[model samples]
Target: MSIERIISRQYEIANGISNDIGLPKFKKYAMCNLRGGIGKTTLAFNLSYLTNDLLAVDTCPQGNLSYFFDNQYYSSQAPTVRDLILPYLVPGLGKATRVASYVGATNEYFADKNVYYIPSTEELYLLPSQLITAINQALGLQGAQKEQSLKSILYSLKEEIDREMEQNQLERCLIDTSPFFAGATQLAWYAADALVIPVRTDQQSVKSLELLINTLTSPQSEFRKYLPTNDLKVPQIQMVVLTHCGWSTVSGARNEPNQQTKVYLKKVFDILSRHRTLLSTGDPSNHLFMLDDFLGSGRISSVESKPLSLLHSGETKVIDRVRVSVNKSVDKCKHQLQYINQQLWG
Candidate 1:
């Protein structure tokens, strides 16, 4: 008969009606901060791995997150983020039959969970130009239609996700984007139901937080101007996470954060605390939280190199001392990540 009838028939065969198929609460989060060196990739990597049934989308041109999971797997002619996203801009590239085709599962990083990630490549750098044109064209559209352009393009994929979630396929979508708040970053923000901004305890981070807060609060900001009005509320569903707080002490005792870090931390806490209040009272959108995850100088996971989280030493020479240092550093980093998550969704 009709398409609607076909869908109804399929639902009947599945032993359930549309009403019985209660989809899980899907959460799309974008982890971003304008400042570089803030361990955004590292936080993204660990969080993605730790989260259950997650689809991690990497929008960074650096491809650091892709590298973490054996870049070869993601880079082996598989559909990259650019391939999937640009189709929306160009049109007529043939619909993505299986959206999961663009994703790659973790080889063996986590024993219990299989985290799928949308890989990025160096060629994604060319996206800025195409993205600008698409955004401009979207802006040119009239009335509410223009506002929905961004979100509408991703609607099919989101529907597929909802269907999968209804079938217990995946539970979450985590978006990891580049440092700049433009192009792909804007798309991630538009798609996210919530945001997790990872910040470092540094002067630049303080400034970045200020800028982020001001931009999201002000309707006149350029970032705010381009956001799809359909399902976008930047400030209400956002959380701030502090990373890389220095705790090193030469006296063989754990030390507090440096004075500069402490000062900036206080400033950030004050800013986010106010936003948290606004999000609670005015918006009442999900939950807003601030977390502290201390990461020292441990080597972060990358395609070319692995994490030092499992460092060992067979030699009895200086390697023994090196192992101790690496082990201690990794422990602190892992603890920080766990603490951040505990505060974020707990």
Candidate 2:
């Protein structure tokens, strides 16, 4: 399809949206790892906000990704991912508009970028029992039914957005999950088309990556063992992102990663190479994407200035300087975003 046609289709969905049909199934990817503090949420925020035609779902109780795009959602009583899946759990309770209803628009930096996000809140932590019940109810005698439950709920959420919105414009779904694999995160995995794991260049992160690979690929891994039947499958990992590489100094000198980080990166590279046939990115080098600390610095998003903006309001020179700095940082992330796009659609 031509870009114009694709945009027109997305615009049509956005314009006629009211509770409706699932047009095209958006490519769904779960951004996760078994460990936290690996910049998963931050990466999610950047990818969702910077990229067009993407929907971000925050399943972590932390709600960091929600707050990243707009701090207002932190305390807002808006419905959340937990709310969206609530009805499915309690069979008799009609599915409420919890998740879809709470979807919010991005602010100025990403203004009207054709992006929508389902925020999260601490309240999600208390809903494990409800999720388990819903899972059990959704799962019939077959393991495939278990997986179907995940897809059905998410698809319903997507279709609901299609019906209620100005346009059901979501083309790609980026899900940010908690470290655990049992509850909401597990459901996110089942509903997704692929996985994007963000791992720091550290030994612990490397170990976590190894464990995640096993869980997704090994037949006897915990994920498969717990799925009730042998037929239930997990999404293939799209790629592993390496974040927090050595920071680039103000003087424009880039620091070197520590020896340990180099060792771990090599180890991860080797592991991905060994599993090339199973990975979306066949080459180890292609699968391991790197992001430097400079790109993640807060200079671009500092809140010391106006509340609704990312730019400074000082003199024109100051504003020009800020713009240059921000654009540079954005440019630095282009490769990362491009790689993510390829993994999602390629």
Candidate 3:
């Protein structure tokens, strides 16, 4: 009866991750999207290092994660852990992608770290052409199928990663994606275990998230048709991290808005809630929470930063004569993640 109902749609996603679980569930990627300086890199880098308990791949053109991992800030001045990623990096590639040079990292054992990091280099700027040459060199396979060539290249990379993981029986993967959503972003999403977006609650940034969801859901998108079904579901977006935010006159600004800024941001976040739910992702109750006032809370390490790290949750303390709510929001995130992981594992 409506124009929306006039079209047909279908998606045939593969099942079965190569795990001992014996079912089709394997989490291979953890990609994120948000602009530069939105703490996207921080969330990705720290979470990867923490969760995987090993090296993390920083796959971006700017090489943020990659550089951080290699620099003295992270460890001794060793040949970057990225060297381990060399085997994964291609040789004399097709389509000429500006792939990260595995040039320095020639160690076989270093790549053996539970986590294998693939840093984004300026070479990524030339990746499109590199891919083609890779295939051509493999056996001189080329033709009009050229358009669909990327799919094969991507699948090959995934296979290699999976092979390495299976051979080593590693824990999981943590992949940091590029800033934008197409090109490299597409590759990372297809390989992701889960996604976590860092949301900065300025009016403009909020608008971008709105636009992203709308664009992804729009009819023109390849994934759009599957929106109403489970097939088009986005990989698990574990949580939305809101940063660079300050309380905007909770009591003085027009009746304090009757709702907290964190709460309103939650509504904006829901634009992708369905995708998270479909993938059986999210901790629901606490998955929707706010970062404590950074200034009010004073500098402290994330409790999750260390296993068994404990802190008082839901405590109300007075700061600078202002009875600001601290620890409550953060506690909510911890609790939410705890419950969600339990449910998922069970």
Q: Considering every candidate listed, which one attains the maximal TM-score?
A: 1
Candidate 3's C-alpha runs over 4 A off are: 1-26, 53-55, 72-116, 128-150, 214-219, 222-234, 245-260, 273-287, 293-346
lDDT of 3 by residue, 1-346 (tens): 1111101100000011111211123455444654665666655543443343232555566766665444422333333223333333364433322232231253222333344454555555555455435545543434535424434544444454455455545556666766665445544555565555666666656665565555445676533431234333345545455555444464544212123454555554555454445333342322332332333232232211221113344444554566644354454333323332322221
Worst 10 residues of 1 by lDDT: 15-24
Q: Candidate 2, after superposition: displacement of residue 194 in Å? A: 1.0
lDDT of 2 by residue, 152-262 (tens): 553443444343333455567788999876667767776676788888878888888888888777778645654544435457667777776553244643333345555
Q: Model 1: which residue pairs collide?
A: none
Q: Which candidate is the best by lDDT?
A: 2
* TM-score to true structure, per model: 0.73, 0.71, 0.55
Task: Please give the lDDT score for candidate 3.
Answer: 0.43
lDDT (10s digit) by residue, model 1, range 1-346: 1122322322222222212222123377778888788878877777765567777777898887777765564446766666667777776776443334222344455445656666777776777677778778887888878877855553433443444444446767777888887667766765666667777777788788777777666777755666546465553444566565553354643334545555655666666556664342332122222223422223424422344333332211233244212334444455445544543443
- How far residue 238's Cα lies from its native spot in candidate 1, in Å, is 4.5
